[model samples]
Target: MPSIRLLVLACVIPLALGFKELKHVSYTQLPTSISSAGAELFQGIEKGTADAAAYDWVNHVLYVVGRTSHLMHVIDLTDPANPVRLFIHQFTRGEGFPNDIDICGGEIAVALSANREVNEGHVRFYHTYTRGSGATDVVLDGYVTVGPYPKSIRYTDDCQSVIVANEGIPGKDEFNTFVNPEGSVTIIHNERTGNPAVQTVDFRKYNTDDAAAWPYRVPSKYIPIRPTVAEGTEPEDVVVSSDGRTAWVTLLENDAIAEISITAQGLGLVNNAVRLPRKDWASKKVDTSDQDGGTHRRMYAGLKSLRQPGKIARLRIDNKDFLITADQGGVTSFTNAKHGFTWTDATTGKSLAANIDNPELKANANDVGYLGRLQVSSLEGKLFDGKNAELVMFGGRGISIWDSKNFVSPMFDSEGSIEEYTDSFFHDIFNCDYIASTATTKSPDTNKDTTSYRQGDFVSGLDVADDNGTVYMVVGMYGTGSLILYEVDTSAKVPIPMFQNIVRTGGVEDTWSTLYTNKKLGDLHISDLGIITSDQSPVDRPLLWVVGAGSGSVSIYNITESLPVIPGR
Candidate 1:
């Protein structure tokens, strides 16, 4: 109303970048004695036996997969620590056993043979750069029946599409026990132009009430029963969502978590899903039959005991829309609340109240029976997506915090729990293998009441440290293999950190399954942490490259000192 009326001005922007500061400290012991200063290559020369669990760091070179020694080693970490092996490929089929390895562009995929006796080809692909040296050509392209094994494998950072976590069934068989159910996930849509288009998606077509058929039987050598497709849901791990469209498979027997949505007119089923029902899902089910009747006879089944499936991380809130999926044990977090993922319940830090059941929300089973396992600093979901958006979970018996805000129907609940760490016998295992280099974790008190956030243990292959968010988690203990460093709170809606240590050093036994780290070029490698990733690490770091499937040899280190002293996380 001021004469002429012409005045427009508006400004009000704050954004909110809080959370960042970490450095607790506890978990110690990463001294096979004390050696690795970083830098070594094919030391001994055997390169024969190696599990090499899971490692990936291309370009600068370093590709390994031994599964059972089907072999695949090519080291040359520019020099983050000194790894050298140039070449060594072997995959005559039958047990090449390579869990995970992806190298978009130059192409180099491997899931390898699988188990239960073996099934034709399983999954394999190579050409890392081809040429000569090894002559290359590990090809096989089409193969996957989904049985009692086929644990993990993921891609899509451009490497086309490859999500194989059949994980199959078998809670137990042989002579000790047997129940088996909930295990099936096959989403292979590879062919990012390279060729080999492979396409598949089957969890028994979605939900069959819980189908079965003698676990499918077939394989007395081939043809034990025939036309089958009815196995619970095992799905160990398979995440395809950096945008490549969509894919989050992870059933872990059956706690549940599927959100498929790729195009080309194919895999469009698996609609939205997120389960957490445990206590045996409810128990009661054990007909245990021989057949005769039909419906496969025998009935009653649903008791892998309470929660089991570990690892399943996916974050992308604030900006990337949203896409949470923590599923460590059964359901500490599960969100698609549109996009922003969700999870939290190490013990009960937060998020996860929808009704709270899955055995009280696990992780404190007396003190640490393993709630599940999680690792996701930021795949990009902004910072705490809707419906209470918030997550932070760690298992065996401690760590929990969920809030999830409430995206569309989001409501995880919880808010603060940390079972102290019940005695610490390792809690029950289930550390999910480990992966987290600092989402955020630091604060002696910093200020404001102190919300709490910190995590560690990306171990799988080891190699992370740009500024020292801190996380090295690769421990094969007893057998001797260490690398533990926590200090998180990089920014935290859930960074992870109760307190941890151990810090750098060599290993023994084989050092737990496989471990990998190439966050551009920091570098680290180990195996036996879960069982295999063989170890042909490559990183263009301070100079890091390793290869020792089992003493085959390859070493090099030169860090001297970085973080709290930098040992293990």
Candidate 2:
């Protein structure tokens, strides 16, 4: 299999193509800062805002979503670097906030979260190609209802079904209380019009231990008392298995992932709850920040964080299944005295020892009152003893690989690699924190590493592509605003993924382009990544379509696939 995805490309090479690192080819920023294609359409737009994205290779069209703006901007990708926006459409619903969009088979679908206040969501379909009624672009089809706060929307590999990660985050009340709606994954079967079939898999049962962890949600003072809800798992994103029959959903708050099989009957009861591992600050070193008024380096024994994965991608190597995730672990900003002192709240009356007994109870003393704050006890089976443990912050800030089986076994991690890589080629200001082109920094802008490409940088999105014997991992760094490519060694029992090259999309001054309406496209927080296989792409090699939610821009890059990869992995 010499990169089966690209067949027609004639080539003669050695016995093996050992891609030690991903090759830096080229990239096209959506707006050249000088892009005046759609200046008349979107005027007064001056912020970094872009979120989920999907591509229609057949039409050479890219669909990017604006989560807060409730708009979907269409771009023609025939010209990779200088993409032209064909049109922009806003959601019809009064409160429709588009979360994710996917090119389902030939039909386009968009997931809409009506409003946080009203936990109602919907999935609307559209014909990829149509005509009449004086319309130049495609038209919307019918619509189907889904769960609340629907975040990640994806089509099964077969393209016959779709999965929506409905994160049931109950909007906070005036008093900062939450509703804690049951998180679920909605599967739309046979996406036909006559009878739309939808199944919502409630994750309450997977809580496993009845009393093991804190309730998914607790009541506020307004309630007579706090009631325990078993739905502790909140689904963030879903990635279908290699075969497309099984869907993997990430539980951000609970540090877990659920595997559910799809069939005509319904979503099989989740028999697998793979708990993510902890990024022990004890064993490994990480770059907390270069701006801590300290040396830019890795630290050890800092506290451990529940490897609460954000988005997950399923990968297959040598016929074995594996998973990768952007270890953007969720940590409460307002924790007990350890985080910071708070004299302005009611909970300040009690000390950690005198008042704190259950991790489910409010761990943050700022009595505006936060329920479901995680604690050390939850680490018993995963990390260590619950008593007197160190609480810390985490995000792995990179990527991690794990066996896709029920047991959580990590194979590798890219901690601090991206930050280290960015320091090598660009300015020092492009550290772990995202750099906006127009935004000046107070941190020392000197001392850049000029040798290594393997800088441990922060990643936001990932897309995978493979060839004969190599795996290519395309990573989007929200921190330094660059698209990174990597090669994974699939020969090992567990695949080993490593850094290769960094291609800045925009953001950095005088790097990707000189055109900066406000910020470079690199400054965009690359959120969604989708690959264009040779089957649909017109170019000589496959391509990648990436969108950043922050810059409200898109990047179309021609990719040479010879290695394995995945999006937001």
lDDT: which candidate is best?
2
Candidate 2 stretches greater than 4 Å from native? 1-48, 93-95, 130-135, 172-178, 206-210, 213-231, 289-291, 333-387, 430-457, 467-470, 492-494, 507-519, 560-569
Q: How does each model score on lDDT?
A: 0.34, 0.56
TM-score of 1: 0.29
Off by over 4 Å in 1: 1-61, 64-107, 110-126, 130-163, 166-184, 187-201, 205-234, 238-394, 397-569
What are the per-residue Cα lDDT tens digits for candidate 2 across 1-569?
22321210111111235433233333433431222353533222224246787887667777777766666777776666567667666665564778888886678988888655336689888876422233456677778888877888888777778889888654543455545456778988778554767888776653433444532322111222222343335688888875667888887766677788877543545656666666665544444332234334544342445566786777787778888887765532222332122111111111232333434332331121111121222223223334323333435666777777744446666645555455445544445343345233311133222111122344668777664444667777764557776656566555665555566645333432232344443435567876666666756466777776655566666665354322220
lDDT (10s digit) by residue, model 1, range 527-548: 3322111132332122233333
Q: How many backbone clashes does candidate 2 have?
A: 37
TM-scores, each model vs. reference = 0.29, 0.75
CA RMSD (A), model 1? 23.6
Q: Model 2, residue 387: what's the lDDT? A: 39
